[model samples]
Every structure is written in structure tokens, then in C-alpha cells.
Target: MSARHIILCINVGSSSCKFALYSVSGGAESIVAEGVADRIGSSGGKIRVRDANGRSIAESDRDLARPQVAVDALFDEFERLKLPRLDVVGHRIVHGGAHHVAPEIVTPALIADLKRLIAFAPLHMPGGIEGVEAVAARHPKLPQVACFDTAFHRGMPERAERFPLPRELWDAGVRRYGFHGISYEYIMQALGADVPTRLIIAHLGNGASMAAVENGRPLDTTMGFTPAGGFMMGTRPGDLDPGVILYLLEQKGYDAAQLSRLVNLKSGLLGVSGLSSDVKTLLDARGSNANAAMAVEMFCYQIKKAIGALAAALGGLDMLVFTGGIGEHAAAVRAEACQGLAHLGLAIDPRRNDSNQDTISAADSRCRVRVIPTNENLMVARHAARLVFPAG
Candidate 1:
């Protein structure tokens, strides 16, 4: 098939469904169109579609009170535009446990298995499954692929993947299944022949994690059994002290839902700043509250510490990559991360860093630095297409 054939990649979240239309030809994928439907199941929802350059092609503010309804409306927009039928549909599933090491052709058995894994990532898995079902309903015979966020971390050594708990828990699949594999995989492909032997990829966004990638495979990562365990995120507690949980139960009489809400909703930068969960907001009003400034500082500190820890895991470091929302856009965060890494020869050219260039490393720097914008959607599409037509 020609590359002009489009692929629809869906990233269904609790509050939104992000869809991207891509044309994959000549081993490269280009965004043909993209859209996001926000506030699904809520009042005042909107859907905005844009072309490759992010120019809005169409937008609507109708009542999309359910995920299925929103997806139908989106397909209607594509039909109105006289777009070609999708060659494949890629869905991002948050966890795959040990079964799915890479993207797989979505079958009845696979869907059942994915449904079983829903307890692993309760907040993310349901919405993802909803998108998959919606797509399957719309195009019953269309090829579908499931790209796992934990698939890349299957590269982790048995030791790194294991927990300190009993073998019973380990056998029951209670171990680390690092999230954000698609992001790390995209970075690895971007590195191409320049792929580093020992590296750490920081995917900093609302939901963040750091993966210690060696030779383009995950060796160890910060995120644990769930996405809620990694480095501090916009609203997550990250690595929490076990004793704090005991205290919350004993002192505050907190239930599972209450604790989940506290850690996943009211923590991280928002908890520290007593302000917004967004980095841009914190940066804007950093002067207003010392707490806000401190929140950003602490965020950077945790990231730097994770980098150092990953370096230690690899015995040394050759490169460090920053991706995702905060990682690509925040120049100050990048500079601050490389500040004390002189010992490892990680130096950034001030001009390059300030300009938000991809290659921000100094010419003579010992360790390389790159700011690769992640394209999980494209990666998902490739995975799905590969599964559907293995020898294409």
C-alpha cells in the first residue's frame, strides 16, 4: 500500500480523546490531521481539528456526553472532509504486564486480556479500552493495534523488574511495569545510529517518568507498578514514603479513594505551590509565592536526582534526552538539569539551549544532550500497521 493511506491513532484519556491522522510513506510518518475532544461526558465540551501545521480545519462545541458520541462526531468531521479510509487504528494501552512486549494485533483474546489488565491502570485503561471499542464498532473489520506503555520496559533485567516482596507477589505480576514506553521508543528511533549506550530519557508532563535506556532499550525506569509511582508529576505524589500512608490511615482515617485522590489529584507541584499544577503558571507567578518557586526547584531537583541515579545504574552516562511537554519546551529546566553534571561532561551551549534547539549539547561536551519532541501517536500507528500487514 502507498504511504498516502492514513492511520488514525487514538490516545483516549479520562478527560479527553486525542486523535491524529498520519500518512506513513517511505519509512517516515507525517501528520495529515489532528484533533482533540476535551471534557468528554461533561457540559461545555468542544472538539477542535487541525491540519499538519496545527491550523484549525474544523471545530465544534456540541454536547458530546460520551466517548462513543465524541468519536462518532470526529469521524463525521473526517467524512465531511472527504478523507480516505484509515488503513489502521492504533490505541495506546497504559499497561500490558508481561504478556504484550510490543504492539500486537488486537484480537478478541487480546481485548479480553487488556480488559483484565484494567485494574493495573484503573484511571487510564478504561478510557483506552473505550476508544478501542468505539473504533472497532465504527469499522468492524479495520485493523487495530495495541501499543503498550510498559512494553519497552520489558527490556529491564529480571533484577530491576522484580520487587523486594515475596516470590508470591512477584509471581502474581506485582512488579514494575514502567510506563511511557512509546515516548522512550520514539526517542530511541530519533537517535537512529547515534543511539547512546547508556542514557536516561525524562518524559516530563502532567504524568511524568524517567527511563534508564541502554542501547535503545529500557534497563531501569523510575515509574513502578503504576504511573502513580514515578518522579513527582503535575499532580501525583511520585515516590511516597510508606510511613506516610500509615500515618494518613491512622491519623486521618483515610480510605483507598481518599488516599488515591490525595496522591493523584492534590499532590506534586500543586500540593507544593498551593497554586496551579501547570509549570507555566508556576513559572509566571514564581515571584508571588516562594512555595511556587520551591515547587519548580523541587521538581527540577527530583529530575536531576533521577538522572544521576540512572547514571549510577548504567555505571556511566553517554547521553540524556528530554521529551514531552515540560522537557521539550522548558529551556530553563533543561539547563538546570545539566548544571551540575559537569563531572559527567554534560554541557549545553547557552545559545542552543535558549533557542530550544534539538541538539543543545556543547560542541566539545563529553556527554550529548538532545531535546527530541515525542510522537507516541506516530509510533502507535507504525506498530498497528506492522501487525496488520507484517511483510508490507
Candidate 2:
């Protein structure tokens, strides 16, 4: 029998760090443990862990105020639980820019390259980098791989990759580099043999974006340049007019810092509704609060429009998938987004959709609408395993 190898997949978000441990031997794999350090840098933060069968292994309050602290806490829990030593680590890096496309073993050069690209994803890169550095500090010789979220979109055609800017700017790495690529890649893997010829995946979550895939190749995506570009998200006002930014700077005396805060933090559902950034929160209050109602409407409206645009990009739509936190759970959002798309032969059975079934499409609908839960952690682990344990 071959030896089992444990892989730790680390996904560092803006406010949380999620880690999963997978045990792989021979041709099989299973999750041995998983946990998340939530509300990092906030009061009342907690780190929770669970075993393979979803049993709580540990739960405790801690001052997880930074990525390094959270990483140390998780490693400490692993020791307390006496878990097997990890063979490798995988990290979900949000941006790879135009250089680091494929999954690569983390190195000093790679770290330096990532640091240079931090300006492209200022809010996310630091946490990812911190996670990597913290892991290195704890397990000096342990192999770590960086699985880029922008890698899946590297095959996009030049027309789709280019921005309507000066050639010099495009050459200087100013172009559409899609995000949520790890999720999209997982969705495609989950489809396996049944993958469609023309598909659009709407990974709706706190951060939302859509990708148009044709014959398993990425054609285009909603997010351009950064994660903040796609559509309206929980906090980001996606695809804002450049003139609005110019006006804010030239007329309103808004500096770069203030503009970044407004566009990335203060806008979107929370800005529009003057409420929480959570979709469920807005949904619950939509009936009573006009602003909340408008916010929901706007979210759905943008999604519907993006579907049409992506569908056109694919020449047609064979399957429409919804995956992510909001995509998998929020039935109302799905229904509203697909409401007026009958012209594209898309219709959802209300009951199936409300139940959050795997296949929510109406039988007669030409486009197959599905709700597939995305597992980006698993994808990162797979890439790490492939790179680190090639013979396994």
C-alpha cells in the first residue's frame, strides 16, 4: 500500500482564513479535517474546526487579528489534535497578473513577483502573502504551491483580454485578468464528461462575476483588470464609469485613498440600501425598505444583463450555472436573474430552485440551469498535490 499524504489548502480572504486538510493515497482522496478562522482583525473572532464526518473537533475564541496569527492558531490546533504532518500546502492567490498563470511551487522569486502584483489586488494579496510567509516560518521545509485564480482565464482571446486603452498601458500589464478562477475551474471539473459546449457560470457571492465558456475554453468574463470590475457585489460597485472616478478626483476633491474606499468598501448593496452588505439581510428587509428593495432589484438586473451579454459572447447558451455562497443558496436571486431570459431558452422550475436542487431548469427550457456548489479549496489541493506529489 502507498503512503498517505496530507495536503493543507489555505484560502485567505479579506476577513477570514479557511483551511482544509485532505488525505490522499493511491488514486483516492478524502478530507481529513477543515476549519476557518473567521472575523480576523475584529472583536469576538473565533476559530472553528471539524473532522471528516463534520463533527466539531475544536472551537475557541482567539485574538486572530492578522493572517499570521490566524495561521499560527490553525497550526496550533492541528498539533493539539495530533493530526498527521502535512506533506504540502496550497494557497489560493486571487491575482497572478500576466506572468504567473499556472500553479507554481512557492519560491523567493515567486514571492517577490507576487509582491509586485499586490498593487493589482491590494485588498487580497497581503493576506495571501502573509499566509505563505507564516507557513514558511512554521514549517521551513514544507512545500507550498500557489494556485492562481487568474490561471483559468489565461487562455482567453486577445480581444477579450485587452482593455480599450493605449497599447503602452496594455503592454504594461493593464488588462482584464478575471478572478474567482479557482471556483470556475472547480465547477468545470465537477461537470466532468457532461460539460456543455456553451456555458456561463455566475459565481455569485460577496464577490460576484460571470464567465462565458465555449467548448470548455474560456471566451470572456465579467471581471476586468481586478475583482472589483465585474458586476455589483456585496460591497463593490463593479464596472463603474471611469468618468465618475475622474469627477470624484477632479471636482469632488477625492484622493486615491478615498476613491478606493468608496468604490471597494462603501458602495454596492450596503451603499445603495444603507444597510448590511449581506444579500440575505437585504432580502429580509426589501419588503419594508425601499432602498433595500432597489438594491436587490439592481443586483438581479445586472446579473440578468450579464447573462445576456455572456450568452451572446458564447454565440448561444446551452447551460447556465450558479455557484458560490449566494449562487448556491439564494433561490430568490437565481429566479430573479433568470426571470426575463425566456428569450434565451432559460427557465427555472420554481420548486426545484427554491429547494436548491442540483438541476433547477425547467424540462422544456433549452438552457440547462444548475446550482453547483463550488469547492475552491479542493481545487487548490488537487493542483498542489499534482505539483508536489506527482508520482502519488
Q: Model 1, 282-343: lDDT tens per residue?
A: 98888888999999999888888888888999889998889999999988878887789888
Which 10-residue window in model 2 sums to the lowest lDDT? 23-32
Question: What are the lDDT scores of the predictions, listed in order?
Answer: 0.88, 0.94
The C-alpha local distance difference test score for the whole of candidate 1 amounts to 0.88
RMSD of 1: 1.5
Native-to-model Cα distance after best TM-score fit, residue 5 in candidate 1, in Å: 2.3
On a 0 to 1 TM-score scale, where does candidate 2 land against the true structure?
0.97
Badly placed stretches (over 4 Å) of model 1 are 1-3
